[model samples]
Target: MRGPARASYRPVTQRLEVTFLPGLGEIVADEIVERLAPARPPRPVPGREDALLVDHAGRLERALSLRTAVAVFLVLTFDVPRPKSLTSGEHLPRIADAMATSVRLGAARTFRFEAAGHDSSVFQRLAAELAHATGLVHDDAEGEVVVRFRRTPRNAPQPGATRAPTDQAGWDVLVRLGGRPLSARPWRVADFPGAVNATIAAAIVRLVGTQADDRVANLMCGSGTLLIERLLAGPAATAVGVDIDPDAVRATQENLVAAGCAGRATVTRADVTAAGGSWRDAGPFDLVLADPPWGALHGSHVTNPALHADLLRVAHEVGAPGAHLVVLTHEIKVMERCIREADAHWRVRAELRVFAKGHHPRIYVLEHV
Candidate 1:
C-alpha cells in the first residue's frame, strides 16, 4: 500500500574501457575524462584502434551515462604463447573461463558474441567452443551478456584487477556494459530521413561551446538533433531552429517536445536564404549550427551548392559579433568554394572529420568577424 516500497537503485563503481569510432576517439576521451575522473590518467590503448582504457572509480552505469562513445566494456585480457594457437583446440577451456568470469563481473544472465567482419567466423567458432566448455548457451537473439572478442594489441596495458588469470596472450575479451550504444539517444522519438547522429551532434555542440545565456540557432535542423543536443550540453537564453520543409519543421517540433525542450526551443518553416525576416528580428544568435543536406544523400545534388552559400550569408547576418557557427556537410568541395567566394564575413576556426552512416562528413567551425 506504500507505493510498492518506492523502487531504488544503488550505484556500482568499476574500472572499465571504452571504444569509439576511429576518428572520434579523442572527443570521446575528453568527454569521459571531463565527466568521470579516472584513477590514473586515461590512456589510449597501445596498438588498439580507437580504444581508451582507464581505471575509473565511480558507478559504472553513471559513468556510462556521461559518455557518448559507441561502447563501454568490462575488459579481460588473455595470453596466447603462440598467436597460431588460437585456432587450435587447446585454449578452449581457458577462454571459456575468462568469458564466464567476465559475465559475472558484468552481472549479465545470458550472453552473445560479436566480432567485426572477417573475424566473425573465428569468433563464432570460439563462441561455440566456449559454450561447450562453460555450459552457457550461445544466445545471439536476446542475450543480456555480450561477450565481444578483440585481438589485443602487442603493447596493451595490463588489467587493473587480478580476478581474471592473465598470461601473455594477444587477445582481449570485452563485455559490453549496455545492450545498445550510448549515442542512440532516447529523445529521438521522431527521426527525419537524414538526421544527424546524436553523438556527432553532441560533439559539435561541445566544439562550438556555450554559456548559460547564449542564444542559439540551428538552420536546416532536421529532427532537431543538433538543437536538442545543444540544449543538453548547457542552458541557453533561447534556441531556434529553421527548415524549408514543413515535414522537417514538424519533426523538429516533435523531437523537441520529446526532449523536454519544447518551451526552450522554437522551430519554423522558412527558406534560410531569405534572411531579412521576423526570424532575423530575433537577431544575432550567439551560436549557429547547421547540418545541411549533402547532395548525394537526401536532397537533390543541384540545390546544395546554392543552399550552402545562402546558409553562410544568412548565418553571418543572424549571428552576433564574435558568435560561433558549426556546419556539418559531405559536400566539402562546394562548401569550400562557397567560403572562398561568398561575401559573408567569417573565418574558419577549426575543422574535424567525423564518420556517420556510411558517409564521412567534415564539421567546420567558423567565427563571425
Candidate 2:
C-alpha cells in the first residue's frame, strides 16, 4: 500500500460554541466539520442539545458564512469560589472585569447581558456588575455585544422554590462572536405568517444540492424563503415560485425585490395543486422545494391531507426526470400516508427532523425517477 498522505497544516484553533435550534446540534456539527474543517470536530456540550463546541482553526468570518448556527459565542470559563461564599459585592467586580476584558478584545462599544438559571435578583446583580466593569453602555434594544452568563455545570436546576442550587460551580460567560444572530439574514426584509427560518431554509437548500443553471420551482412558496435561498446559493437557470394567496405572492415579490433577485426569480399567484396542465409549459423543473402549511395551528391542521395529496399530484406533473423535491413540514403521518397513496413516480431519499420555532418539523427529500 502507498504511504499515508500527510495532513495539511492548520492554524492555531480557538474554542468556539455554536448555538442551534434544539435537535439539530449534530447537523450543525456536520456542517461545521465539512465547511470549516476544524482541528477537532464539533461535539455537543454535555446536557445541552442546543449547543456544540468546536476548536476552529479557520477565520471567524468563514464560520459565520456557514449560516447554520443561530449564534456563535467565544467562551470564557471562570472558576468561582464556593456557593454564597462571594456575594455581588466581592464577586461582581471580578466577573465584570472578565467581561470587560472580553469586550475590549472584541472591540465593541456596547453590550448586553442575560442570566440563565437565575431569578430576577441574580439577573439584576450580574447585569449590573457587567455594566459597571465594561463601561459599555447597556443597550438591550440593539446591543453590539451579547454577553450571556450560565451556571458552570450546565442546565443545573434554576434556583427556585421547586428546585435550588446546592453548590456554586464556576460560571461560563459566552460573548457573542458577531453583532447580530446569523439566523437573521439581511435578505429577509418582508415577513409572512408562516415564513420559514432563514437558517432552516438554507439547510434545506443545501440538502437538495441544486445545480447551477438548474430550473427550480417552489410550490406554495410563502414569503419566498426557499426561492430566495436558492437564488442566493447559486445561479439557477430559472427560479419559479407559486402561491395561491395574494398576500403571500405580494410579500414574496417584495422580498425578491429587496434581495435584488427580482430578475432572477419570479413569484406568481397560482395554486400549485391547480397548476395542472397550465404549468406543463413551465418546462419540467429540475428541482422542486416546498414549505406547505403544516396545519399546526388551531384552524389550518384539518386541510393538510388534501394539501398533501394535491402537492404529490402537482409534484408528479412538474418534476423533471431525476429531479428532487424537498419538503419541510410537521405533519409526518399525513405526508407519509399521502406518499404511500401517491400515484407519483417518486421515493423518499432522505429525511430529517429539525426544530423550528416551537415546533419540530421534518424535512423529506424525494427523488423523482
Candidate 3:
C-alpha cells in the first residue's frame, strides 16, 4: 500500500494571515520566528482582533506545524463592488489558482464557503462558478476546502455604524492552508473531561520557556498535556505527572505513549496535596506545572480556594529554590488569594489572559521564593 501524498507549498513569497486564540499574539509570533526563521515575524493585523500577518518565503509545512495559532490562511483580495462580481472578474481564476496551490484544496473532492448570507443568490451563484472553475463538488457542510469570505476592512468605524461591506473595498477570500487545524493534535489518544485545548497547551509550554536540562513536575496533570508538550517542546532531564485519579493517571499515560514521549516521562497516581516527600523522591524540580479544576467542569467555586492552596503547597514542596510554577486556570480570585497569602514562599512574575471554548482563562506564572 502507498502512503498519502505530502504537501508541497509550491509557491514561496506570499502574504499569510493568522488567527489565533486571543491574548496569544506575541507567543504565536515567537513560535513562528523561532521555528521558521528569516520569514518575517508575525505582526498583528490592524482592526482585526486575534489576527496576524506574516510574509513568508519558505515551505508551507513549517507554518502548518505552528502550534500556538488557530488557523493560517492564504489571502486573496478583490476590489469588486459586490459579492457577485467575484464570480466574473479575473478574481475567479486567481481564486482557483490559490486553491490549486493548497494541498488540501487541490486534492479535495468538494469545497465549501463560510460567509455572511451564504445562502443568498449571490453566494450561491459564486459557489456554482467556483465549482465550474475548479472542478470540485460544492458540499456546503462538508467541503474539504473551507473558504472564509469577508469584507476587507476599509477603515475604523463608529461603534453603532455598520462596518463597510463587499460593496466598499471589495471582498477577502481566505483558504486555510493546513490539511487540518493545528489544534487537532494526532497524538491525543485519550481525553479527560476538563482537558485543555492543544493550542492552549502549546502556549502554556512556550510561556514556561522550556530548557534542555530542566527537571519538571506536572501537578493535577489530567491528560498529561503539559507533560507531553513540555517534552516535545525541548529536552528535559526528567518529567513526571501526578494526579489523584487513577483514571486521569491512565489518560495521561495513554496520551504520553501516543505522543511517543513515554520513555522520557512518567505519570504517577499520587495526590499532589500529600506530603511532598512522597513524590519528591525524584528530587526538586526546576518547573512545577498545573491546570487545576475550575468551578465549571472538574471542581466547584466553594472548594477551589482550598484546592488552589493545596496545589501551592505541593509546588513549594516539590519545586527547587527560584523554580517556576506555571498554572493555567479560570479560578482567578481564589488562585490569586492563595498566591497572595503564600507571599512568603512565592512571587508573581506574569499573568496572561486568553480565550478558548467560550471561556476566558488566565495563566499565572510565579517564582518559588
Q: Pick the candidate with the highest lDDT.
A: 3
lDDT of 2 by residue, 1-369 (tens): 999999998686667888988756656777898888887668776557788888877776677776668988877666765323224566655555545544554436677666644345656555555676667777765667777776666544543446554555686777776567888877777788878888888788778776886999998888999999888878998888988889889989999998889999777788677745444466589998888897642226788889888887788778888888898888899888988886357789988888766788888899886
Q: Write the per-residue lDDT of candidate 3 for residues 57-100, one digit (tens) a residue.
A: 88776778788888888888888767788887678998877666
Model 2: residues >4 Å from true position, as ranges? 1-12, 82-110, 117-129, 139-144, 153-169, 275-280, 296-299
lDDT per model, in order? 0.76, 0.76, 0.83
Looking at model 3, residue 362 earns an lDDT score of 92
For model 1, where is the 10-residue window of minimal lDDT? 161-170
Query: Model 3, which residues run further than 4 Å from truth?
Result: 1-11, 37-41, 104-108, 157-168, 276-278
lDDT of 1 by residue, 1-369 (tens): 456676676444454778766667778877887888775667887656567887776756555665357777777665754333554666565456545655554535566876664246665676666677777777877675677667766544455744433333476667776556677777888888888888788888777777998999998898899999999888999889998889899999998888888899878888888846666666679999999998555676688888898888889889999999899999999888988886358889988988666688998998898
Give the lDDT of residue 247 in candidate 1: 87
Regarding TM-score, does 1 or 3 come out ahead?
Answer: 3
